[model samples]
Target: MDALPTDPEPTDTRPTDAAPTDAVLDRAAGAVIGSAAGDALGAGYEFGPPLPDDARVGMVGGGTFAWAPGEWTDDTSMAVAVLRALAAGEPLDDDRTLDGVVDAWCGWAVDAKDVGNQTRAVLGGLAPRTAAAARRSARAFHDTYRRSGGNGSLMRTGPVALAYLGDGREGDLARAARAVSDLTHAEDDAGDACVLWSLAVRHAIRTGVADVRVGLPWLPATRRDPWAARIADAEVSRPRDFDRNGWVVEALQAAWSAITHGTTLVDVLERAVRGGRDTDTVAAIAGALVGARDGASAVPAAWRDVLHGWPGLDAAALTDLAARAVRR
Candidate 1:
C-alpha cells in the first residue's frame, strides 16, 4: 500500500455552476460510466489514508485487493445488475423484477472479489427466486448481524433512480429504492440513504443539477427532517470530516460532503477518493450523483476510456445498459 496523508486540506468549492441539458442517453451513460470511473480511480487507494498534494492520485489500480488498473469492484457491478433487470422493462415493485435482481446479485456475490459483510451474509444464503425467499434471507442476515447499516446498498442504487425517471412518482421511486436496499441491508438508515441518494441521482439526471434537496418531499416526515439536517451538514464539511468506513450514514455524509463542496464531477470524485478510507465506494456514490448532474461529457476521457469491471463489462457495455435502461 502507498503511504497516505495524515491531514488533507478542505476542498475548494468555487467552480461556476452550470446546468446543461443533455440527451437522456448521455445522462444515463454518465451515471453508470461516471460511477465506474470513480470506483476504478479510488480502487487503487482503498483504506490508504489521505494523500499529500504532491502524491500521484489517479486511477493506478492495485491496492489492498490488487485489482487491475481501471477495474471497478462490486459497487458498479451490483448497479449493473439492477440496470440489466430494469432494461428488460420489469416493473420495479413486481416480484419478477426483484427476483431477477436477486438472482443477478447472487451470481455477482458468489464471484465478487470484494463483497460487503452484510451483503455477503444476505446473498450467501439466498434460495430460489421468490419474494418470501428474498425477505427471509435478508431478515436472517439482519438477525445474525444486528447492526447492519453498511453502505453496500447505497453504492448500487444509482441505476434504480435512473430506471424510474419520467415514469414514476417520487413515492414510487422511494419505494423501489427502499425495497431493493432492504434485500441486503435491513436497517432504516441504510434504506434512508438509498432513498435519499437515489432521489438525488434522479433529480440530477432529469435536471442536470446536483441538488439533493430536490428529493426532500418524497421522504416521510420521520426521515425528512433528519436527512435535511444531514444534507445541510454536507454542504459545509470536508470529506474527511465524515467516517468513510462503510457505515451508511457516514458514507452518505462523506459522499455528500464531497458532492456539495466540489464544483465539478471530477472534483467531487477526486475529493471523495483522496479522502482515503472506503475511497472507492465514497467516490462511486458521489460519481453517480455528480455524473447525473453533469452528463457523461463531464467525466474525464482518460478514465472513461479504460473503465471496466466484473462480468467483463467495459465502458461501452455499461453505457449500453444505461441507454437501454432509459429507453425502457
Candidate 2:
C-alpha cells in the first residue's frame, strides 16, 4: 500500500451563498439519478451485448433479443433499498445499518429477480441468524468468501459517500463504505477499493475536479501495491499511458483521468464506457463522480426520462431519496 494523501485545502467553488441544504440535495439527487441512468443505459450491454447504433432504441430490437425498455437488474434494485435505509436515518458505523442492508437484500430476493452470484450466496448463508447472530455470523461468512473484488459492492456505494461528506470523522467515510461492501465482499482489497472510489467521488462532487494526487496521501503504507503506485503515477503523467483494466484500481484511475481530461459529464462517462472491459461499472462509477460535480442538471433529459420508468425498482423513488437524504 502507498501512503494516503494528507488533507488538502478545500477547493469547493460553488457560489459562496450556496445553501448547505441545496448543495446536499443536489449531490444526492445527482448520485441516485446518475446511478439509475447508468444502470439502465448499460443494461442493454450487460454481459457484453452490443449497444444499438441508434442509442435511443429502447428495446434491444428485432433480430436481437429485445429486453423490455428501462428495466434495471439487481444493481439498481439493491441500491434503492440501501438508499431507503440510509434515508431512514441508519448510521453507517452502527449494527443497525448492517441489518438494514441485510433486510434490503432479503426484500429484493423476495421478488426472485436476478442477483450477483456472490451476493446471493452471502445473503442466503446469513438469513437464518437472529440479529446478534446475524451480525456475528455475517461477518464470519464475509471473511470466509473473501475473493469477490467485483464491482458489485462498489456500484451501490455512492449514497454512503454522499451522506458522510465533510463530517470530519476519521475513517468514518471509509468505514461506512466497508460496512456496505462487507455485507457481501469482505476482502481487504474490495473494501479498500470501494473506500478509495467513494472518497474520489465525494471529492469530485465537493471540489468540482479534485487532484487525483490528493488520493496518494491516503494509500496504506505496508506493501508497495503496484495498483496504488500506478494511480499515483497517473496523477502526474501524460495522457497516453493510462491503463483501463476492469480491475478496481484501473477503473478508479480511468474515472479520475476522464474527469481531468473531459469538459462535460457525458464526455467523462463516454470515455469510461469506451474503455471496455467492465464498461458499465466503470461508467457508473464515473457517472457518480461527474454527477456530483455537475449535479442532475448536467445529465441529458432524455436519459433521465428513460431511467425514471425503469422496471422492478423505482428509479424516481431512489432519486427522491437522494434528494431528501442530502438536503441541507
Candidate 3:
C-alpha cells in the first residue's frame, strides 16, 4: 500500500471576510447538484459494458438496485451525509464531525436501497455505531483482508472540499479529505485518492478550471511521481480503458479520463457514465470536478428538475444544503 498523509486540519477560522464569493458559491453548489445528477444519470447503466458512441444517456434510473428515475444512489446519499456533517460547523477532521458523519451514514444505511459493500460491512457491523468503532472495524478489515480500496470513499469526498473553501485552507482540505475517507476506507490508496480528488474539486471551484494534478503537493513525496504518471496516463486514455472502475485508483483515472475528454460538464458526465462498470460512481466522481469547474448553471435544468435522492433532497435543496454547509 502507498503511504499518504493522515493528519487532521490543525487550524481553522470562521472568517466572514473570506466567505465564498457568488461565483465560488455557485461552483460549490454545482459540485453537489452535479454529483447527484450524474449519479442518477448513470444509475441505470451500472456494471454494463462500454456503451456505443451514439448511445443516449439521461437520468433514467433502474439497474441492479432499481433506482427511481433521477434518483441518486449510495454515492450521493453518502455525500449528503457528509454535507450534513460539515454543516455542523466543526473542523472537518474533528471527532464530533466525523462521528456525526458516521451517524448520518448509519441512519441512511438503515433504509437505503443500495449501499456499497465495504461501507456496509464497516457501518452495519459496528457495535456502538460510533466513529471510533467504525474506524477500528474498517482499519482491521483492510489490515487483515488487504482489499479496501473501493471507490466508495472517493464518491463522497467532494463535499469535504466545501468545508475548507476559505482562503489558505488547502492543507485543511487535503487533511480533511483523508481523515473522512479513513472512516470507511482505511486503505492508504483510498485515502490518497480522496485527497487528490478533493483538492482538485476545491481548485476547480476556486479557479473555474478542471485540473486534477493541483493536489500532488499534498500527497506523500514517495507517491507523488507514481500519481503523476497515473494522471498522465489518464490524459492520453479513454475512460473505457479503465475496466476495473470499482477500485479507487481506476475510479479516479476513469473519472479524470472522462474529465479530460469532454468540453463541458454534461459531456464529461456522459462520457463517465458511458464508460460502464461502476457507472454511477465514476460519473458521480467526474461530476464533482466538472461541476466545480463549470458552476451550477452548466448543469441542464431538465436534469436538476428531476434529480432526487436520500433524505428527500431535490437538486435545489441539494444546492441550498451545500451552500449552507460550506459557509459553516
Candidate 4:
C-alpha cells in the first residue's frame, strides 16, 4: 500500500496549542462517514425489495429507492443520540444513560417521523426515577423487550465505543454499551454482544485493525453462554454464510466476524448484507465498526454523498463530535 500523503499544515490564524493525531482524526471521520453511508445504502433495502448485485454499488435512496435517497433509519438516528449525549460528558450509569437515551428518543419522536415500533414501545414505558421499584420495573420491562433482540441496539452502539476510548477504564466502554442497549434490549446475550462489539470497534480505532485480541476477552464470556456461543461458533466456521433473521446473536456474530476477517470496508459490509436477515441493520453494525478501524478515506466517496438525506445528525457533525470527545 502507498503511504498516505501528509495533511497540509493548518493555516488558520487562531492560536492553537496542539492538533489531534492524524490517526484519531481519520478514525473519527471514517466512523461518521461510514456510518451515514451504510445507513443510507441500507435504508433503501430496509425490509423492502432487493437490489441486484450489479446495481448495488454506489446505491442510494433517491426516487429509485423507497425512503428517499440518503435517508437513514432508526439505526443511525439512535447512534447520533448516543453520540450527542456523551459529547455532553455524562457519566455511564444505567439511570443517567437511559435518561439520555429516552431524551434522545423523545426528541426524535417529537419530529413526528422515522420511529421504530420496538423502540417506541420501550421508550413509552420509561419513567424518570431512579428508585428501587423504578429500577426493578424498568429492568423487567427492558428484559421482556430484549426477547425481540432486534439489531437496534447494535446499530446505535458505535458512539459509545468512540466516546469511552482511552478513558483508562477497562470494560467501561462495554458497560456503557450495555447501559444504552438495555434501554431497549436487556437480553444478556444481545446486550453483552453489543458491548463487546462496541469495545472491539474502539480498540480497533485506537490500535490497528490487526488486533483481534481486543475482541478475545469478551468472547470467552460470550462463548460460555449457549446462545452467544452458537453465534460465535457459526461465525468462526462460516462467517460469510451466517444467518440474519433479526436474531440478535447471529447478527452480532456476523457483524463481528465481518470486521475481523474482511480486508476492506466494502468487503465487511458486503458480507454483512449477504447474511440475508435484517440486512440493513446488520450492514449498519458492520459499517460502523469497519469505519472506525479504516478511517474515512477508506470508504468509497460516491456512497458518502448518497447518505445526505438520512434523518438525525449529519456525518460531518458526528465526526466533529467524536473529535471533540477525544480532545476532552
Candidate 2 per-residue lDDT over residues 1-328, each given as its tens digit:
2354444434333432244556656655776667665555555554453333224323231122233455555666777766776777677777766676677676566554456666666676565432344445545655676455656677777777666655453256666776777676655566666776677666655655544443333446452265567666655642223333344556566566656666777766655554545545666766777777777777787676556432344555666777555542
Identify the runs in model 3 with alpha carbons over 4 angstroms from their true place: 1-17
Whole-model lDDT per candidate: 0.79, 0.59, 0.86, 0.61
lDDT of 4 at 303: 65
TM per candidate comes to: 0.90, 0.77, 0.94, 0.78
Deviation from native of the Cα of residue 114 in model 2, angstroms: 3.1
Sort by lDDT, best first: what order?
3, 1, 4, 2
The residue-by-residue lDDT of candidate 3 on 95-184, one tens digit each, is: 877787888899889998888988998898567767788889898878888789999999998888987776668788888898889899
lDDT (Cα, tens digit) per residue for candidate 1, span 1-328: 1121222221112221222224656877888888888889999998878765346678889998889889999899888888888877788799788888888888877767898777887777677855558778777777886777899999998888766676344667778998899878878888888877887787777667777776666555667788889888877888777765589888888888888778888888888987778999999998998888888888888888889887888998888878777766
Error of 1 at 235 (Å): 1.7
What are the clashing pairs of model 1? 5-50
Model 3, 102: alpha-carbon shift in Å?
Answer: 0.6
The most accurate candidate by lDDT is 3
Error of 1 at 6 (Å): 46
Query: Which of the predicted structures, 2 or 4, would earn the higher TM-score when compared with the native?
Result: 4
lDDT for model 2 comes to 0.59
- Residue-level lDDT of model 4, residues 1-328, one tens digit each, is 1121222222122222245578866876676667666666666555543334334533556332356666776677777767766677766564665566576666576564466666666565455532233335446666665455666677877777666556444356655776677666655656766756776667666654623235435433434356445545755743335545466766666666767667798877765555554566777877877888898777776665456533445556667777776565
| TM-score winner | 3
